[model samples]
Target chain A: MNSEILNIPLNDYKTTVESLKNEGFEMMMDLTVVDWFRKKEPRFEIVVQFLSTSHNKRKTLKTFVNDEDLSISSITDIYPSANFYEREAFDMFGIIFENHPDLTRILMPDDWVGHPLRKNYGSGRIPVQFKNAPKVD
Target chain B: MKDYKVKKSKLSNFKNKLDFWATNSEEGGWNISSTDEGSQKMLENENEEQIKIQTGTEVLDDFVIDEETSDDERMIVNMGPQHPSTHGVLRLQAELEGEVVRRVKPIIGYLHTGMEKTGEELNYFQGPTNTTRMDYLSPLFNELVFSLTTEKLIGIEVPERAKTIRILMTELNRISSHLVALATGGMDIGALSMMIFGFRERELILNFFEKTTGLRMNHNFIRPGGVAADLPDGWQKDVQEILKVIPEKLQDYDDMLLDNPIWKGRLQNVGILTTEECFAYGITGPSLRASGYSWDLRKSQPYSGIEKFDFEIPVLNEGDVFARWRVKVLEIFESLKIVEQSMHNMPKGPYKIQDKKITPPPRKRLDESMEALIHHFKIYTEGFKVPEGDAYVAIESPRGELGCYIVSDGSSKPYRMHVRGPSFCNLQALPVIMTDSPIADAVAAIASLDPVIGDVDR
Candidate 1:
């Protein structure tokens, strides 16, 4: 229940993950991004959840990413489970996973325009089209 | 890893040789250059088929590969965006060489309604309504995890009665969810009776849920501070009926499927997933337990005072479709035990926390007291503010580790809310389980994994 939270630098994210992997963290529970548009200096924060099954512990690894540089090295090499998650983060927040295999949008259509989860992207902006329904302005 | 040498199709006479593009999202449909050559080079340098099954000991005997089939007859097969067996809009593209599955890619997102985007817009109070839709089978678990995260951020505790109520409801929900998994899994493998029996038993639990939560699915009953309402009068009788009937029905399932040769043939030694593979893929719940790993979040973490009850985490070493099915069957018994204990030890107190900011005053009090009326108005309109910090709370849902991570900016609404859906993570293992197996086994593999697309595409 007592999860250790570590805020690692962007450069040290992979190294920290590797060390954690060596330190009995066999399972990567979850990976997601929180877009802090104007509130923080860095526009996005990548949050990774790791579980050490042998040690019976959980760890949360967080790293910040600037708006200008939206890419981070994918941890799919270490935790293969992160494949879909990284793609989801890419689809939602537009945070490119640098070495992700098939880094296409996993949750959105391929032709969709903007990241939906980003603060700048407004919800209910796109109108739905029905065959015989009347169109709304 | 075995290499699949695919021969070119002998249709050169045709003007255009039609290549099967599994998904429109896959190459040349929407036309996004998704292939990363640098990553490809790195993976190739490391090893082909980079999915590492890191068993400290020798791999299990069931993971035996058959004699190499001729790749000359290889073809791409797309199963389900509409197929009933895929369990809700999950599309899987498998490379098949003469009925043997070579590789699989699960193309999700058909059910993506941008719920997470909608979560950013809803406040902490309204959060459960959004989350309950994800993993629709176990709606209470989603609500519970979301509420727990919100409560953690707010730094408040519900009463003992509320905790006990939550445990009771969630355990029953687990039984219902597992019943659906068993039902659908049975239906996939040609056991029509099981589908009927599972639903018949599950209807009892859904009826109980409706009596308590007012709706069958997407209850949104379990709130941040506590449950929305107290257990309805004579709820004990409803639970007692479930406890009485489900065990009898489960015995019937065992008799029907356990020793049946055809059932065993279809499930056993098919879709083998080693513990190492499960760990690598982050597959928890029965799938991970089926692979001989005993990692249940409820027993380990003990949220919402569930540690008060006594139950066992059923584990099997087979790591095949049969083991996964059997593990779920056994888990229902354990969940039943927890539910029975919770029923006996049901506490008598408030359903929600006593804090005025978190819980609104009763309707009678609203007319009597002016302050109570004001509190209700403010709470409903503005909502209670959580402290400026983030917390992630995970619980052992029927599926797996259902976690909710919430970031608070000292506001009523969550700054960012993300759900770590176990189905989504478990779907990553489809390729590992389905590869080198027969095409028929792929259906069983998917059914055993039980990737509910609502959770995956959420």
Candidate 2:
């Protein structure tokens, strides 16, 4: 019910987050990217949730990232915990987080080919071959 | 390149060392630079030896010392991806200078099945089944958060009985989860009897769960509208039995390990995480509380009528492995208290909401009424639709604050569904806790954190 969402432009993103940190939103609770693909322009939306323990308040921040330019400023400097969350967002959505300490894959294997969570990516499975079993054509 | 040995110092000097370690630990302890030929050659030689050992070609050397390496030399060691203490498939690449752990990087994802991606494929009604598997230990908490998010998006209030049932089951789940944490934590610290006692008590709660939910682990009992079914007959008797027995067992555990010197030595003052570090690292729940930050989602956020129940959030200023362990033990008593309160104050009513769009018609109603029959047929076939919006709901899971974020585009299936697993966030604090500690204490630190790999890699 505490739907206090702040939609900020790309330019003001870092400054807004820095101010939020200064304003006592000490914890960056969750960071994730929502890919819209053909449904909406600026194909990706970065959603972040911040919690201020002192005030018991939660704020949700939303920012858009275009598919052509998938890079965004990382908030890891403000919240060291954003390190893994940023890596996960990068791993799943292929959105580049500029200045992230280690922006490599966190959940997926390093050799994995594509970002699996992207809407454009197919959710296909590999066929299992059973040894010494008859195959049905 | 300089000598890295920390000298024995006074209390104030040790505090300074802790502060220095806190800042420098983030750089990661055991990094091998590509340009550093000596360390890189040592690494390659170690790998070659590993290959030889695997192929049964190398002789086992228990105490072979190389003259090339100095006394203060640091070497990289892999604790697991297989080691019993690393919990499950968690590979920790530690930088060790003798028995001391200089740095640790927890490499996970071996158990990753992409549950978040799987959640998108499932509709709102079937969402719990996917989320429930994320935190296997507290499966109900996962389901509860997912259902809470869905219910938030739909703007529907469940019945009082349903809310009470959710509280009752989740509190019981918290006890079972903490019991496993205690068991594993005790086992890691060499308190084998404590492990057995912990599991023995846990079996009683698990039996109650098995009787009610019909599954031991991933019970998708908590749904969007409400719970799957009503509590079975004689449920109160089972509840009473758990309440009567666990307190005595807890007393026995206290008698066994409370003042034991070995237990204190292994856990106390090891893996000290202060409140500032907890906030910066986004640590929550008992780990944060153990650091003296008195915040619990159950107390502060209060979901599913949880605030109606009376319970205290245990806090300790030490923030060491002992404090984390002690916080969890104290939390079990608090959860038991909540369970008892919910059982006594439970109101009789419908299990789920009576909305025709959400809850399906009863079996008896389906036989009598054509409208009810149509409703039942439609509900299961396509599931219910949610309004166009996004909502994030957080609840105090045993691990920490487990949150679910759902984005809906006016459809039965969520456009995007993401679970903020506490284990995933809590794993980031590993370097801070494990760095500069002894190898054995590293195990204790990890055990105290109590991260479920399923939850972390999900």
Measured by TM-score, the strongest candidate is 1
DockQ, 0 to 1 scale, candidate 2: 0.38
Clashing pairs in 2: none
lDDT per residue (tens digit) for residues B305-334 in model 2: 987888888899888888999999899999
> In candidate 1, what are the lDDT values of residues B360-379, reduced to their tens digit?
88889988999999998998
Error of 1 at B200 (Å): 0.5
Badly placed stretches (over 4 Å) of model 2 are A125-137, B1-72, B368-370
Q: RMSD in Å for candidate 2, one decimal?
A: 14.3
List the lowest-lDDT window of 10 residues for candidate 1 chain B: B36-45
Chain A only: give the TM-score of model 1.
Answer: 0.95
Worst 10 residues of 2 chain B by lDDT: B53-62
DockQ of each: 0.35, 0.38
Instruction: Name the top lDDT candidate.
Output: 1
Instruction: Let me know the TM-score candidate 1 reaches against the reference structure.
Output: 0.90
